[model samples]
Target chain A: MYTSIAGSVARPSEVRLQSPRPSIPPSTAQPEPVGSAFADLTVCRHSVTMSDPRAAIVPAPAAARATDVAIELLAEMGQDFAGSRSIGETLRRALHRIVDHLDAAGGALFLLEDDGRTLLCTASVGATNIEGIRVPVDRGIVGRSVRSGRGELVGDVRTDPEFFQAVDERTGFVTRSILSAPMSVRDERLGAIELVNKRGEDPHFTPEDLRILEAMAASAALAIVNARLAAALVEQERVRRELELAAEIQRSLLPTPPRAGFPVVGINVPADVVSGDFYDFFELADGRILFNLGDVAGKGMNAALLMAKTASLFRCLGKTVHRPGALLARIDAEIAETATRGMFVTMVAGILNPATGEICFANAGHEPPLLHRDNGTFQAFPADHPPLGIAEGSADTPLPEATVHLDGGTFYVVSDGVTEGLTVGGAPLGVEGLQDILREAGRLPPAERLTAVTSVLTAGPRPLHDDATVLAVVGGSAVTRPRSGSAAGRREPASEELVRVSVPSCADRLRLLRQVVALSATQSGCCQEAADELVLAVDEACQNIIRHAYHGDPTGQIELSVHHQGRDLIVLLRDYAPPVDVSRIKPRDLGDLRPGGLGTHLIRALTNRAEFLPTPPGGGTLLKLVKRIR
Target chain B: MNTGMTHRVERRQTGMVVVALEGDVDLQSSPEARRVLLDAVAHGGAVVVDLSKVGYIDSSGIASLVEALQKARQGGSRLVLAAVSDAAMRVLQLARLDRVFVIHPSLEAAITGDR
Candidate 1:
């Protein structure tokens, strides 16, 4: 009364039964009688079915044994996985248990990849280096089980048409049978668990084994999904912290607003946590103030880095390069060397003379800054050349320089983000809208005007889609608070006989000399052209002293005297340096096409009888330049 | 501090390189101007420096032109000044360099080697 079943007992009714003491078919077909100890045991070949009367009596106990084993295995797997540290370790332990409990040669656990069309073997047991192998999701028997969301039992995989032999070839392991079940949780199929070969006397996997694997797969899928979510959250947090640190560093590089008495105000607001817009204004060594506003090409960390480098370069080069065009050319060369592909900057830089409310600016492919005149009108200064970093070296066309006399007026510069900002109706604010805002704020002070512009931007229905930056320079009547020791605020009395000023012999210091000479020339009724010539002559005289007498030493002293005697304007420039040889003081031949030796020539050409005389007591050179009014 | 200046190069059909200069070429920009002029001279052809747009030229800028002349002589070419501004013409007259280089009133005249 013993029976053995093999090759997946899919239906219990398929096994025929025979009575022990009854006439069955023939004497040759009689079943062998078993002892009491083996009475309930049933054995059947993988391809054959036994015909014994008591064979049906043995299947009940065999089915019950399979159920007990499946329940025990699932309980043990849950406890083992709860103690595992990582998803990979849990899967490795589960694969080992599945192979050992099912009496199989080897097993592999594959997880679905993010792309959803492939399965990656994350853990393998009893296979040679099969971990990390990839298989298409719809290619093999394992794929079928995962796709169908069911367990598959192939008794003799060599005959099963869906059996893929690639894994066997890759791992060099022979596969006789396969039992695969889909790993899924709540109707979501993650991957599949595959057992390669049956190892016990049965030699083929049973249907009962397939049922147990499917149950264990459900628990494993849940554990893996939880671990993956945790890892992703940790990575997200790390990236968020790095961005915040980058934003803080960028914020420190921004310039702060000047305290009271200064007429410049600048502000920047970032669309993201970091900004690519920057503005800076600082007084040069001379009394003239230098200011610049720039916008980098893009947003975020790369743009912020370039913005910092550009601002720092302007500060460093602005001290020596008084010309805005030259400074911008140098900056363009530097940025072109190291900037990322498709990266460039648009900038507007200027120098302002607070004494006369005169401002000169150079534009480099930036939005034309608006000049708010004292009469409450706005004029736009357009871009003169291509943006920096587009080409190497100086621009082919002159960088446009505009001189505006701001008397109780303002000069406003804004990034495109201000004009392109959106309104409640999804329409762009445009340049006209900006003009309206600037006109309204024209009556307010410099700081309050900036506030009004910012309030309009933030109070809009839609937030800014890009970084916004604004810089305003208030001039003329607004600049009544004169700096200490500045002669611009002092008016000489008609009875005063003389006005004298002394300055260091430097290129930048020449501006002060020009200012004082301009005042004297104007007082003497010299026309505008004559006044300009007087300033140019004095500047050339001092430059000659610095270049020739002092040999470019900026620390030397040059005493300048300006006096209006009747209808003639007189200017005396006396330098305390080694006296130049008067006989050799001649302008170079212009036909020679040389760069030097023009300073002395310019001095003589622009003045009325320029004379170089010997100083009696000081032993230096005395240059007297006179301009007579018509 | 008014060091406003700009420059550009144009190649003519007659194989002359015309470097047009504008604004004030002074001590601040003369070195760069010198490098540009010398580079043009090294190319070994008739080089014309157009100063039509130039409002002023200082001693250092004039020196750059002189250096370019020497380089052009060594390179077997000629250097000319064209479209010299009135403010710059006064400096040339005072320096007497007007007699040195072939001066032309326009870039076209300089390219055709016209006086």
Candidate 2:
């Protein structure tokens, strides 16, 4: 028996000596004793009872007192784990408090590392600091407790085979008895808590001590799990923010919107934070627009990185390499040297000559480019070579280059994502669907037409599985005059003189000449379209006289006359300037994409027969242009 | 709008320059048109020439626009023709310049540079 501050009570160890199974008297069970409330909280494996009813009169029985201490210790440890932000610091403090409460020589808390095969000592309170000690999970008493998912109570370490001696030998700590309890939440085994050598007369830990330690281990396991989950969430958020910034930067590298009359336009939509598809177009110094569209084999970061590399390489080298095939070959070689195996790029590169309305292009394992003609016909040019990076410099064979005249037509180049894109019905939008969309929006401007087509695919419920991109080049309308049987083909009864006027050879007089021709042609039974053509033709003819014959001199004189003969209108202009070689007055080649030389072409295009008339007088040049009324 | 004698130059709050020509653009008036267009291009901002009120445009007028465009391109600036009249459009189409020069349907569209 021991004497407590409240009253005399049987010591916990001495009570165990009294009987194997004790019984509580009826009187003791009826009265509520002070500090005995914790008796119910203690998880008792064996039923505890008072031997005598008289002994229960005391404030607390030996077993009840021991239960109170255990409940208090567990409550304090729970508060420590819950309130502390630094779990490491809180755990170390917990181990220290537990050691003091149990009167143990030392204790250590081990946690399972990510590898799951090793136990790392994370917190310790003992003669030796084993805070960074590592041991295999199958090595010692601690490992055994964790592996078995149970608590271990060692009465004497020298006799126990599970006790590992290397740790004590290294730290110089004399370990006698040991208590190890595994930390677990449900079926998940975290690690184990180990206490060595009881400090009092009893050098071994009691079964009650093992139960208390196991309860503390459970709380620590839950706290560590929560901390790890929080860390993972924070890391995920950071990666999301980084990806958003990368997408914005990728957008900045793309070309700006072209000027209103610019011939080429493009659009790109990515399925994720970054895109594997890219397109670019820029005007070369020679007035031809160079353009390209590429698709990497995959999606996400690796593909996006390759997309950037390929796009930039095209833009940088395209400025100098004029041929589409040669440019693709160069890019292919560059990419093949560094690109990952099994990954490749499908690309279509082209150059558009706005002046001649010609497009020269090369396709490398890409979707065929569609040419929608003004006369309601369609033409497609398929790939002539394999995709880049598949075979080094795959475009070695002279690619089958195609030149198409865009006579009031449009050329469309798109990534496979456009054709393979899902529609509202969850089916792949085949080439036919894309063509239908294009025909529906054919009359719209080129940019709006592309938008209309892309919107149909993008408007579906599902996200795009691949990157979608489009590039369009709209052709100019070809000049076509009304034929003989058309609405402007009305015939007059007789030929008549339309107008006769003369003025100084000056640019200012050209407009007056245009008005004269417009009035005369209208009066001579010409339709509004034919009259407009006559006005422009005469205007251009007179301007040529002022610019070439007069040499921009305002002193020279010019005579303009318009005559109508049945279905024919003839315009005559005589400039009083020194006439020279008539054979040298030829218009420039129309293929030349330059300004100024177009005036001569414009006159010839508007008239059926434009020729230099036989030198009329002593020192003047006479030019006549004939236009059929139809 | 038929005056053929007046032109207005406006600098909007968006830092865009607008040169509005209200008349026929021909050999006689083209020199003045060229001066206004070039000066706007030299200002180092996007320039939009509104030709909605132009009744007619001759080759000389087209030449002046081409010269301004060349100068704008040399300066790394932008120049676009907006609201071109039908008569002028026909002339440009005849010259095959309708595909060369950037043409917008509205002055606002030209200034915004969306297309």
Cα lDDT, model 1, residue A95: 82
> What stretches of model 2 exceed 4 Å from their correct place?
A1-97, A100-103, A129-139, A158-161, A164-174, A394-400, A477-630, B1-115
- Candidate 2 lDDT over residue span A1-630, tens digit each: 222322554444234323332233433333132112222222232122223343333434564666556555554555555556677897899888788888888999999888989999999897788999998899889999999998899989889886888898899988989999898767878899999889888777987678667766765676667666766887889988888887887786577888654678889888898989888899888778898889999999889888889998999988888899889998888888889998899999999887667899999899999998754457999998888878776545445567888765789999999999999999998999898777656645578778877788889999999888989987652112122343333221134666788898877666677778888887777888878877877877777777777788998898888877645787878888888466455454544556566567567667655656567757688777777675
Q: For each candidate, give the interface RMSD after superposing the true interface residues on Cα.
A: 3.4, 3.7
What clash pairs does model 2 have? A261-B102
Residues A234-351, candidate 1: write the lDDT tens digits.
8888877887887787677666667665767888888888788888888877778889999999988888888889988988888887777777888888887778889899999988
Report the number of the highest-lDDT candidate: 2
In order, what lDDT does every prediction score?
A: 0.73, 0.76
What are the models' TM-scores?
0.54, 0.55
Candidate 1 is graded, for docking, as acceptable
lDDT of 2 at A261: 46
Residue A478 C-alpha lDDT in model 1? 30
